[model samples]
Target chain A: MVDIAAELKRPKIDAHCHVRAGREEELSSQRLVEAGEMLGITEYWCSRPITARYGSLEEIRAGNDAVLAAMRRYPQRIRGLCFVVPGYYREACAEIERCLDAGMIGVKLYHQYKINDPAVWPVIELCTQRRVPILVHAGYVTDPRTKAEQPRLSHGADFAEVSQRFPETMFIMAHIGGGGDWEWTLRALRDSSPNVYVDVSGSNLDDGQVEFAVAELGAQRVLFGTDGTMAGCVGKVIGASLTEEQRHLIFWGNAERLLAAQGKQPLAKIESGQEGVAG
Target chain B: MIFDINAWVGSWPFRSLRDSTPQQLTERLRKAGVAGAAVSQIEAILHRNAQPANERLAESVEPYRDVFVPMATINPTYARWEDDLRICHEELGMKGVRLFPEYHGYEIDGPLAKRVVAACRERGLPVQIPHRIEDMRQRHHLDPARGVPLAAIAGLVAAYPDTPIIVTNARGIAQSPLWRRTELRDAAWYADTSLAEVYFQGLDKDLALIVEESGGRHLLFGTHAPFSYPEAALVKRATLPADADTLEEISYRGAMRLGLTPESWAVKAGSA
Candidate 1:
């Protein structure tokens, strides 16, 4: 027997998985535990959803707190981020400050909330001053334009602008900056502020674009992540191309530095295939 | 073992034929470390007459007989389908039959399809019916497969019960409602993992898991023949590695029980 699990056991660090503790319709907690076990990934974070009426400040607090609570319950395995609509900087700023001080490591901006908008300035300013990383939904030009109204999974250009505006905050250019095209993404990354980093979060195929990011911006800019709940179809074709070295970086290396710089222990460092060790 | 169970052999007509000759297909497979491959003709999928396509497919494949075992496509709608089948087995030396039910305007449950299936079984060949050729939303509109009815095909499996049927070009099994029915379950049908996971939905075990749970054997592999980067399938297959026994069953043993002779099946045909 060729030990298939070994063939797949390079380890994974899901830098941007959705942290939906209260929602069962999508990725439930029980399913997350099992899936984490199966894919050999122990850490992931979910972004909070932006809403229609946008809930009350307390309601927003609960949403952020709920993800923190879930991570607390499984402290040895998960990481989390508090999501805020970029359009509501007042409530988003308060939530970001509260969550960051409480030990939440990152910030998430999602659907319909344009990164280019002026309202997101407060949160961006706080992230820059505090050095908290932000993962925005950056999509390609050809994708449904409405994703901007929903969830923009790729936001490189806006990230560039924001990264330039806020030098201290580390911006993760997620999904290889627009559905895995290195050439175009490179132009965006190269043009962006040096603070911008690309996360191989959802798409882990290690395309030359990823190499391009590493080549142009250095490997420290590359982070590993899985869209977790929907790591199929996308992961299948793309995962095939990832080499073991890239897996190590995306899984935990970049994440470790990000956390250590923030004065926190990296999530259950299982490197050397050990029970627990430094990542 | 990870194998591309559904790739093509020669140049495909819808797009372009494979970039390589038959020997090139073998060389390509070898580069991926694949021991053997079960290959079909891409040109046969869309060419109105299966003769020229079949003829070129057979001739191109002759030199690499050991590594490239052929599965001839017999369009039940083609003028000389029976002749194609005969030339495939007796003349070209194929060990299986592939069907394009949707493209040919015939149902898998139709009488001509049964005749074709019977001809294949008599000659100890496994029948291959692909569910689709191109991505439904991505096809160029000039040549699009009408798409087969998965339920009707399931019905055919229920009727046959004992016959071996392999569905290639298999994708979107998750979206199919027929397999979800609690009242009906067909144990005889199987599928190849082509166009299976283009969505990154973690649907790797989706169809196979369903088939396996339903007491069905869903053969897992890729469809790389004539594809631009045929090695693309190899990357997809790597995400899905079966255990030794499961690999034995899918990569060869199970196909043998379907009536594929020892001369053509992957495991038996080569040291791989």
Candidate 2:
């Protein structure tokens, strides 16, 4: 019998997540970690919450600083993703170096510029040299409301283009469900190079989405994420028709590979005897 | 045992759904720990006349009658829908009705909708209105149905205070102005937890907050299955910060009070 309850309690990594520092917001950082922990999410690969402004260096630094603080507050539960805007190529590259030096495992890019834009190439190249994955803000916003709000949002086509240009760099397309038009996004991702992976996260709990992503992108290219909605995030994967191996890959195995490739380690081992690292 | 108040059968044109047949739906529900579900037909939303869809739903679920409670959909805008409602209630033995105001192109507070609600009230059957079938942002471009706002549902509730209204696939109820109103609180209405969430995009909103806002009385356990994963609601229910009584109420009691009885025979030997 498939012990689904035990599977739900397995130590999983949420690849795309956000937390707020207690500075401007309340102790939402603590709440995000607690909520994920309650659902057996052992680690959060998180960045500061996305904002409307991605053009300012000060804002970029502020976001990364918040993530650093969250990492310090929950050293065992949180792993930092350095947030940066690639429009400032030189400064963006420098920030990547600073964050990686400070122990962040990956880079998070938002919608100031498309991932394929020439402005972002240097940042991609920097991450490639540093052996860290770039978690790019991706969505195919077809609806008027999201379109108007995220006119510059990156889509699967952008990832396809960027991934091909920099074949050596690994790219994670953020939030297949969070992005508008998931079906369209999945179709677009079919042409993306193998380096482009998609995270199954967001509040839209539509059935068959996780299975569809695994089918379209292949199981190895899919990662589990909450994007803030923890239960829905975990549930969509559990609800989908997947084998134990596919579930493990999406839940933690693929994340383990990514973390290992980046030469990072979880601050604490999983107490459930489900070691996050495959040693 | 969890009783899912919202579920569907039939093919959705935009996307292919898994486990949508009556037999398939039961297995899906069982895997998610749901003992029974009140199911509606998806084709009714798109069909100009819903009687055929209702007939299909009744026939499809005939084999698995104990595990599935057939809920008919009647587009009041269609001609002679009262007769269809009568056939569904009297002949088909459907427990209740589900309406699609946005897809059927009728206002929630319009005369046609009122007739449906009034008739259901007279029959002592609850009316379930799905706030949306598909998420608006990701819906097929050709499909232009918008979500029925909470205010419109609230308007219907105010007009027919005695009618039992169950709103499924609803979002942002806790944040809406109608939340916690005396009429909503006191009425025999409920909102299912299929689409409810604890947090989204860094906001402290969704299910847990909704339960806190409503004091857990107005919530029901729902999966929106086949269209949505049953595990979504199941996980949300598992994480609710409620005591045993409140959890029981949300899980099955609220559904029971709505006149939905989980067939005792459907429970496995050791479950009860």
Candidate 3:
């Protein structure tokens, strides 16, 4: 019998979490990290949250700065993902170099430009050469209202197209359950690109989502993420009808392998009973 | 023991569900450490008349009475609903009734809704209102289902302050304007911690934040399972930064307060 409560206590990695640096974002960041800790998350891949559809160059830099700040504060618990807007090619490339030099593990992209957009190509190539993953914010929105609203939001097909082009670059699709039709998103992701992996994040928590994603995309291409809903994400993984090996892969094995290949190690010294020790 | 206040055992027409049958639901719930669940039928939401669905629910759950607390589904808009409600309570031995105002095509705070609540109240039965059966964003293009708003629930609770109200599969109840109203807040009302779970926003918006905000008194454990995975809700409850008392309140004590004690119900039925 599966002891789910005990299973939840197993150490894992949260592949997608937003940890910001602004006055208010700091509190949100702290809560997210604390929640992850309570849920036995060992490493949090932190990114700067972008509220606007399109952010200024300064905003993008500032977002990456916040992630860097979080990494400095919780060196073991937090792993920074450099956020950039591919539309700002030169600046975005420069920010990626700066963040990567400062120990950031990968890149985080939003819908400012679709993954397949020409402007994003160089960014993908840069990450591919650097041997880092590009985590793209994607939504397969079937809802006409949201679809019209976020016309530029990248989808599974966009990732499929872009990923096929840069077969060497590892691509992490943001959230299958965040919004839009996850079923449609999973269906689109099926047998598309081996380079394209998806994070089981977001608040949807639909039954059979994790199982379906595993079956559709294969376990190696599925990652664990909360996108802020920490417990729900953990629950989706533990609750699914997966082999222990599959659960391990989703929880931290895939991430551990992927980051290790990029010469990145998130947890240097896993601390216990460390709370409210902000730098 | 964990008593899940929100769960369903029947096929969802829009999407294929795993472990949607009573036996499968029982096995899944047990694996997740849930001792019992208040289960309804998924077909009841879309079926023209909910009587047949309720009958099916009774038969399906009969074999798993130890794990299932059957809740009848009533479409007040359908004719002879009163008779169906009576049969569900008396003959079918249902513990409660769940209403789908949005799916049933009627105003939640309208006279017909009030009549159902009043009738259930007289029978000392709780009324469960699921905010949405499926993720509103992921519904089939042809399926036009909408979620039950917090405002409509406020209206229902304000009108019937003494009625035991269970609002399941809802999000943002604690942060809603209606939740701040004394009339709705003080009533014998409960919301499940299924859909309104942890999110990236500030602690005040999701279920984790509300455990402190509402003292866990107004919250109950729910999976909205088969439609949603039960593990998500179970893990969410385990991660709540709450004291033992608060956790117990949300897990099963609150449900017990709502008269979900099958032991007492059986004794009462036998005596009657």
Candidate 3 interface RMSD value: 2.0
Per-residue error for A181 in candidate 2, Å, reads 3.1
Give one digit per residue, the lDDT tens place, for model 2 in B61-160: 8888778888989899888999999999999989889999898899998898999999999998999999889877776777775888788888899888
lDDT of 2 at B115: 94
Better of 1 and 2 by lDDT: 2
lDDT per residue for candidate 1 within A1-279, as digits (tens), equals: 122344344455677765553554234444555555655566666555544445666666767776777677677766678788656677778778878887788897665456656677787888777767887765443323333344534456676776677776787766652343344555666667766877654422222344456677766677766554233322332323345555456556777777776777666656465522223
What would you estimate as the lDDT of candidate 1? 0.59
Native contacts conserved, per model: 0.04, 0.62, 0.64
The best-first sequence of candidates by DockQ reads 3, 2, 1
Q: DockQ score for model 1, please? A: 0.16
**Pairs of residues clashing in candidate 3:** none
- What do the candidate models score in CA lDDT, each in turn? 0.59, 0.81, 0.81
Docking class of 1: incorrect
lDDT of 3 by residue, A7-114 (tens): 666778888888756775567667666765667787889888565666887888888888887787777778889988888888889999999999998999888788
RMSD of each: 5.9, 2.8, 3.8
Query: How many angstroms is residue A39 displaced in model 1 relative to the true structure, after the best TM-score fit?
Result: 3.4
Clashes of 3: 0
- Please give, for residues B81-122, the per-residue lDDT of candidate 1 as tens digits: 888889888988777888887777777888988888777767
Residue B202 CA error for candidate 2 (Å)? 8.0
